[model samples]
Target: MSYTIKPWQDLTIQDDYMFKLVMRRKPICKRMLEKILHVPIRDIRYSDDEKTMKFQYEGKGIRLDVYVADDKGTVYDIEMQVRKPSDDGLYLRTRYYQSMIDMGLLEEGADYDELNPSYIIFICPFEPFDKGRHIYTFRNVCLEDTSLELRDGATKIFLSSVGTADDVTPDVKRFLEYVNGILSNDAFVQEIDQEIKRVKKLEEERVRYMTYAMKMQEERKEGIKEGREAMQHEMQHDLALKMLKDHKPIHEIVRYTELTENQIRKIAAENSNVSFGEESGRNV
Candidate 1:
């Protein structure tokens, strides 16, 4: 809904479609990765599902923002997260993403060693950690010996745009600024900006993006509404059970718990201990 309310011309570099379109250019993606990882990306290939990808398990779906693999067999999931997920839970989501990507990389009988190295990168406008740093890189290490590495060939990186620390390079800072909508003179960022303009000019692409945005918004709001309704139902069920234990009158229980007469009777019948007490009272 917000995307619809926002002007089409006001779309930022961090907008999901814009992010994908700009990064689809190999040169731009390679440069961006070089800046983020501080290593040269000689050549990189966008995944076949570069624009849109779905990872679903157990009837739940997650759409990957941008996915790619470099010439050296290193895989990257670069996501521009405009909204901070609940309670900075993005880290846990990254863990889930790493597993999902790993599941897709190997064939039926592929060796474990054949699994390509992965980097799960999240570019956020705000600090993911409360700590003041532009970049946070995570890898599994031994708790007893900090020097010991798990060597699992996986890394998760979170980069914030508003960090005040002196840790990021000028180009990195400029790129982050550009993502935040501050115009940049940096060459790599300039190329990205040009691509953004080109993408905005595509009438068909813009229409597709608008449609996808509305569909996702509806799904998200529906999920939230369903979650609230389920929670209320659970609360009512708990209260009904407690009223049954307390030997409350069936009609009173139905009135307070908003349950049907038959449902209240069923709950009261389920608690046979309460029935025994009622029978003893009737005998007395």
Candidate 2:
């Protein structure tokens, strides 16, 4: 896959890396949650410095853009999604993330009832559900009785930048508009814009971005090199197979295809229909 690194100065809050940096400001993050959830957040703390969690037992992991917990034991995992998810992909991802959050909170042999309430929030520039709503909040509910709630303590919220409905607070509206590249006079928006400029001016941040881009480029080059080698290897085996089918001796196939005797024999072994033989007094 090809990756083009955007310049640091060109980054906005919508950028995942920038968003994570901005959310590191606890005041801004807490205010954001309060505005979006329409609740008061006394205080919040980072679950980890990097907000990355790994499910080592399953060999799977997630790198969250922002992960925090409030004084009330409520956990929030915020993500900045630039691309639109296909069908229920995002919803399913929320399910997996919620499970990971629960797994992280519980100790070995811990009671399930001790699980904290968690929220998986995705802020996107594009509408996820095509519902034209500024925000979509989901929770488990009984299908047979719509009024019956499962109260699973797990919630998923999707905020859309292009939403048409007036379903969010003024602060959230300003935030969403800012995400859409529309500058607002709102204090929160101005603060975020200033933070973007401030971060871009940091020498260490510039170096970090540069290093990341260079690393990605190196990995891409390595992948291309490996791909080419793999193609050449497969081509050699194909040529060896064709030569063997043409009644060529093992040594002749080896000299032409640059394949060893063992490799040619292995290919012949797989293709039971192909006749295996040595000819022309060649010893392989």
Candidate 3:
């Protein structure tokens, strides 16, 4: 026997849902960073507010989807992109964010004696660079000699072509797959069935309100159109009377109003007694 699927059985992009799927995976991210960077993480703090975060580039402001920092003063900016960005675009964002994090450490006139390392981890569904299969880690290097590497400031990690069920050692990979799977699978419908029901009810209510708003807008348009037509008719009538008083030929008034001579003459006759009073005040 086939079972009927309920319409109100889908996960919504609510804050709680996002927190559970993404932010809750902070431990995994911290573990992955520690493994890759070989640094010990004392603790991880996730920022929910966008104001606390800093950005580098212009145009559109970077509202960090998820921002976390390790206890050792190493900040990790992990962003999720549904679509892939170009290599240059990705690097630009990563470098800009990394620079912002570094700049935040020092105050004006203070000696740049000590600064903590920072890492920006970008997780994209689509692969941006053709580096290799699994993961790519990048850092600044001396162009003159391939041997020299800059280890002073920041590092970047890019995870590409990652899916729900892929063999990976890093804890970050597991968390990424889990979240992606939950979003793209029917299991979430089964797991969070009650939340799905609530989301569906809210969606239906929104649709109903939108429908009512549309109807009200249509009615307002119709009223405005009728009012405009009435004003046009009144203006045409006044024009007809003025032309008649000025001894303008009926053809002229008809041409102005796009009305036949009989119509213009009738309007003129109806307002024949009506006189346009002289200007009460003269221009100095």
Candidate 4:
């Protein structure tokens, strides 16, 4: 909550907010996707680009950085992951996002075959899988027979900017290097840099970023408050347990812990090993 907010002027393409803004640009988003996918994209249209998609009866929703669908109905969710997550966490996140995308695309009574092909892409400034490859793409396939492909139409791609292998094209490598804080004259990178500069100068975007920072700070403060309260409650419960173990009177234990008689009774019931040393009928 006490951390400094990064000035809009200091933001780069790697920043989450900056990345989302740049990806919102149709040309940049399309080209970036093409560069990562190594395929030509005729055109792309936004689909729940900024809006968080919520599923029926689901409380939590997913906010995708860039969600778009190409002319062929193939969908894409592109995210810039600056922090390295646990391997399992990252994999589960992609799985959840994939499921959410599917839920958002298919309507009630729609045929299963109507589902469009989709890709969940995460761009990381650090090596994610430690494979030393610029890109790692995943698709479902039969485990026993490696040659057998599932053709599930769902793909998850992780791009590591720190990759050492010469597995990606020069343009892609240049972009990745820029993400890794190495400046380059690549046309796309230059355009993205210009866009970041433009966004920084816009008063409206600056205000938006400020609002976002404030909200994040408030959330952090609230989380800290809740944690402290929970810790205090747990401490009280622990103290009450110790007192009970010491054969302290129920009323005395309640007075120390500030716990209700019924609550203390429940605790005692749960921990039957604590023997009572005093009468149960003590005055409040």
How do the residues 165-252 of candidate 2 rate in per-residue lDDT, one tens digit apiece?
A: 9888888999999999999999999998888889889999889878867886897788799889989999999998887677787878
Candidate 1: where are CA atoms >4 Å away? Answer: 1-4, 48-60, 86-88, 106-114, 247-284
lDDT of each: 0.79, 0.86, 0.57, 0.86
- Each model's TM-score, in the order given? 0.80, 0.76, 0.49, 0.80
Q: After superposition, how far is residue 210 of candidate 1 from its true place, in Å?
A: 1.6
TM-score of 2: 0.76
In candidate 4, what are the lDDT values of residues 132-154, reduced to their tens digit? 99999999989999899998799
Clash count list over all predictions:
0, 0, 0, 0
**Worst 10-residue lDDT window, candidate 3:** 275-284
Candidate 2 ranges with C-alpha deviation above 4 Å: 56-58, 107-110, 216-284
* Global fold similarity of model 3 (TM-score): 0.49
Error of 4 at 164 (Å): 0.6
